[model samples]
Structure formats: structure tokens, C-alpha cells
Target: MGYAGRHVAALLQSLGVACSGTVRNVAVAPEVIRDAEAVLCTVPPDEDGDPVLRLLMKQLRDSASLRWVGYLSSTAVYADREGGWVDEQSDADAVDETARRRLLAERQWRALARDKGIASSVFRLPGLYGRGRNALVQLAEGRARHVVKPGLVFNRLHVEDLATAVVAAMRRAEPEALYLPCDDEAAAPQAVLAYAAALGGFEMPPAVAWDDPSLSPALRRFYAGCKRIDSRGTREALQWAPRFATYREGLQDAFRG
Candidate 1:
């Protein structure tokens, strides 16, 4: 299982709900799909398209007990809003190859559910961090960086909040539903790193320019995006709210842990 899938599965198991999942590069047992009441696909698409659907579409279609399907997608599906707000109804204008692939995978999953008369929900996730996977860990490992870019902001969600929203969505099982699970605040990357440093009593790392030559291509692409994800509709529909409503609370929790 990947990061989000593992947390979701753990949450389900803790609630005494039976769950099964496939690990990356591992062959999945047919019964994993055949006997489930619900299925959540967290796999990302490759150049060839959705690997899960390629291998398991037949099993998913044939499953007698499956009633609901969920797909984890990226907020990158929405075009960069130039620091404006984007909601669930925002048009998907995927600008990058990775995001385009994700959008395609979302369509494939929704089509499958529609064909089978099963409810399907898609969660559009922003940057995710929690516990061991947070800025504190980065600071401790000496890999933390403070990237300075004025008017640039990014949305994030704590993994625990993600798990909670996913369970809530499963309970609702709304047909063709879409969700944006994000914290209340859209913050600058450097601000988050600075806050983490203060929380963990570590010295703040030197700020790097957004155009720093040392930044990886992927990191540069991340900085190119500027949007505030609006999750009000998701909250109203799911009756859910993030426990860590801002990066401050999320980093605080990670610091304490």
C-alpha cells in the first residue's frame, strides 16, 4: 500500500471494517476485489494509463458485493488559478502530463461505476503531510528547504484528516461525487518550513529563490502552481472538517508526536 492507502486501510481496520489492498508492484489476489463491499483505488496512472483498471477491471465488474468505488485524484486536475480559489465545480484544465494522466484515470473510474450502476466518489487531494512524513522529519533529516516566492501559496491536508474524510465519503456513497480535502489555510512553502522549525526548535534553513538553479525540475513545477483549494462544498456534503485546519496545527501535532 502507498502512503494514503495505508492510512485509509488502517483507519478502516481500527473501526473494525474488513479491508484489503494491493501494494505497489505486488500482484493482487482476485478475492481482494471480489469480496469487498467497497473498493478504493489509489494507484496513479502511467504513460499506458491506469494500471489498476488494466489488470482488475474484469474483477471489479464481476464483483457481486461491490457497491461503492472511490478514486484518489490530485487537485492538479484544476488549472492553476493564479492564487485564486478553486472549488469542486472548477473546470479541470490539467496543464502537465502527470495531471492529465490523473484526470484520465478519474474519468475511467467514474465511467466504470456508471456502467455498473454503482456509486463512485473521487477525492482531489492537495499536498499531504502528517506524523513521520512532515516538515519536522525533513528538518531532522537535514533535508528541509525554505523556498521564497511572493504571492505563491499551496494547499495541504494532514493524512489523518484525509483518512477521516475518506471514511465519511464511504459512509455516504454518493453517486458521481467529487471532493476536495484540504486544510482551511493556503500558505507559502517557506512559511510552513519556518513554522516547523520554530515548533521543533530547529534553526530555519536558508531561504532559496523560487528560481534557484539547484531545485529539481519536479520541485520547480510544484512552485509554478498557485491556487487556494476551497473545500466548503466537501465539508457541507460530507459533514466533515479537518482536525488540523491549518499548517500550524498540523505541524504542531507532528512536532508533539
Candidate 2:
């Protein structure tokens, strides 16, 4: 299990819900799926496409007990809105091959659930952070960066919020539903890092221009996007709200944890 899956499992188990997970090989996945009343797919699509649909589609299709399915997708499917807000209704404009694959996988999962007469939901998530995998950890390990770009903003979601939102969706599953689960604020990456450093008593890194030559290709690409994710509709539909409404609270929670 990856970071998000692990947290989700932990949250579910804490609530006394029976939960199980598989690693990369998914050796026990079919059995788990067959027995599960609800399934949440966190695996991402590869170059060949959705590994779950490719490998476990038959098992899912045949599972008699399954009533609901959830797929974790990325908000990157939305086009860069130049710091404008995007919601669940926004048209998808995947900017990269990876995002395109995710979009395709979302469709595949929705289609399968629809065909099976089951409820399915696709959660389009933004940057995710939590204990052991946050800016605090990055700063502690000397990996934090402060890249400056005017009017450039990004959204992040606390892992706990994500877990709770998923649980809420599971309770009220809807057919082919789409959701944007994120924090209330869309802030610059530098601001988040600075807050993390201050909260953790770590020295903040000097700001680097967005176009700095030292930035890696991946980092540059991350900065290429400028969008604010709006999850108000998601909150209304799921009857759930983020406990950490902004990076400030999220980082503080991570620090306390």
C-alpha cells in the first residue's frame, strides 16, 4: 500500500471497519475484492493503462457482494486555470500523459460500475500530505524547497480529510459521481514550505525563481500548473468538511503528530 491507502486503511480500521490491503503484486487482491462489500481503488494507471481494470476487472465484475466502488483520480485532469478555481463540473484537459491515463482509468472504473449496476465515485485529488509524508518531514530531511512564482497557487488535502471524505462517499454512494476533495485555500508552494519550516523550527530555504535553472524537470512541470481546486460542492454532497481547512492547520496537525 502507498501513503494514501495506508492512511485510509488505518482510518477505516480505527472506526472498527474490517479492512484489508494488497501490495504491488496484488496476490490476495481478487479474494479481497470478492469478499468486500465496497472497494476503493488507489492504484494508478501505467503506460499500458489501468492495472486494476486489466487484471482484476473479471473478479470485480463477478463479485456478488460488491455494491460500491471508488477510484482515486488526480485533479491534474483539469486544465491549468491560471490560479482560477476548478470544481467537479470543470471540463478535463489533461496536460500530460500520466494525467491522460488517469482520466482513462476513471472512465474505465465508472463504466464497469455502471455496467454492474453498482454505485461508483471518482475522487479527483490534489497534493496530499499527512504525518510522515508532509512538508515537515521534507524540511526535517533537508528536502524542502521554496520556489516563487507570482499568482501561482496549488491545492493540498490532508490525508485524514481524504479518508473521511471517502468514507462519507461510501455511505452515500452515487452512480458515476465525481468529486473534488481538497483544502479551502489554494496557496503558493513557497508559502506552504515556509509555514512548515516555521512550525517545525527548521530554517526556511531561500526562495528560488520558478524558472530557476537548478529546478528539476519534474519540479518545473509541477510549477507549470496554476489552479485552485474548489471542493464546496463535494462538501455539500458528502456532508463532510476538511478538519484542516488550510495548509496552516494541516501543517500544525502534522507537527503535533
Candidate 3:
């Protein structure tokens, strides 16, 4: 959560928004957000379930002042489209364990809002990348890998664009809405890395087979899926588009930073 929350908090604070506090611990959410009118939950679900809903369901349901509730979810919840496009109305047949759990958590939040009449918005985010977490940083630290896999494509969102989308959602206070926020372009990891290398003036990292035994389990899982995600529905609904429309622009921004 620290990855996106800290950047988002900074952005919100700069916009003159009155943010009470960033809730680092779910157990203390009730106290931290006692008087908040709008709340954004970026907490990830564990094996048990969504920690925030599990811990602060009563407090959230009881808060009369709470108007807008936003839950940050992932695009992994959608089924693999084999490099095809998927949108908000697409089939959400989550195959992996993590995606399955996230789907359950999303349902829980939507149901909670319905039962309590709270304006709930779920933003299904794609792979996130920004200043300190982009290909530039990865290549600078010599940790960038070019995983060679045919027909593999991924959609990514710059953290700043995500921040913008979330703030727009807050302004509209859309009730019981689902959105998928991603950049305009979806490409392979190698293509992104090559672009980053050109900007950083370094040779691209050596290619690694997608099935290399040295790859971590998490990376293996990431490589297992190939899909192109589209957020046109979200853009139309929120009247917002990604500032960095593709990895090329996003990586350039990070490199400039």
C-alpha cells in the first residue's frame, strides 16, 4: 500500500484537499477516519480477506458523514483475454488464487455500500508505474528483466494518472460504480524495457525465458497471463483520461524525474 498511498496522499495534500490521515493500520481506521467525508481504501486483501472491511465494517456502516467510498482493486480480477481487450462489462472469471480473493473482496465492498446506501466506487487498476517504481528505476538498480514470452501484453497506469482518476471519482461521488483505469497502450515487457534503456542510455537487459527456473513464483504468475485491458468505459464515465497514455510517455516522465 505504501507504494501508491504515499504518492496519492502527497498529491491530494497538494491539491488543498483536507485529508485527515493515511490509515496505515486497518485496526485503527475507525479512529483515523472518524470524521472523513470521503475515504479511499487501498488496502490489499490477504488470505483471510479484506482487512479494512473485516475490521471497520461497523464503523463505516455507522458513519453518517461518510459520503464517498472508493476501493482500489486490480485488473487481475478479469479473466485472461489472450491479448484481446476487456472492459467493465467483460467476464470476471478470475483464475488465479489472488485474483479470486480480490473478486470476493470487491463483492463484499459493493454489498456493504448497497446495504448502507453509501456512494461506492471500485477502480480496477492495471499494473502501476511511476517515478520511483517504473522501468527507469528498475533498470538503474540493475533489476530490470526482459522476459521473452510470445503474445504477452500488459496494461500499465502511471501513479499520477491513477491519482487523477481517483480524485475525479471522489468529485463525482458515483454510487455503486465499477471502473477499470489503465493507459491507452498495452505492450510487452521487453518493448517497455527497450524504450527505457534508450532513455537511460544503457544496454537493455539480457532476455530471460518466461519459464526460467530462476524466476520467482510471483513473476511466473504474471507471465502466465496475456491480455490487453481497456478503460474507455471508465474514461467516458469519469470524464478523465490518463495523462500518460502509454508506457513510452510514462517511462519518459519517470526518466525525466
The sequence of per-residue lDDT tens digits that candidate 2 reaches over residues 1-257 is 68888888888899999999888766788988888988888888887668877888899999999999999999878878887889988889866887889888998899899899999999999999988889999989888888899889888999999999999999998999999999988888888888888888999988898889899988888888899987889999999999999999988888888
lDDT of 2 at 148: 92
Taking the tens digit of each residue's C-alpha lDDT, what string does model 3 give over 1-257? 46777767777899998775445655566876677788787889887657778878888788888888888988888777788888888888878888877887888888888887878898888899998998888888998998999988888999998888888888888779888989988888999999999999988888999989999989988888888887888899999998999999888888878
TM-score of 1: 0.96
lDDT, candidates in the order shown: 0.89, 0.88, 0.84
Ranking by TM-score: 1, 2, 3
Model 2 spans > 4 angstroms off: none
Full ranking by lDDT = 1, 2, 3
Quality of model 2 by C-alpha lDDT: 0.88
Please write out the lDDT profile of model 1 over residues 195-257, one tens digit for every residue.
888888899888888878899988887888799998999999999999999999988888778
> Model 3, stretches more than 4 Å misplaced?
23-28
Q: lDDT winner between 1 and 2, please give it.
A: 1
Measured on C-alpha atoms, candidate 3 has an lDDT of 0.84
- Give candidate 3's error at residue 153 in angstroms: 1.2
Question: TM-score for every candidate vs. truth?
Answer: 0.96, 0.96, 0.94
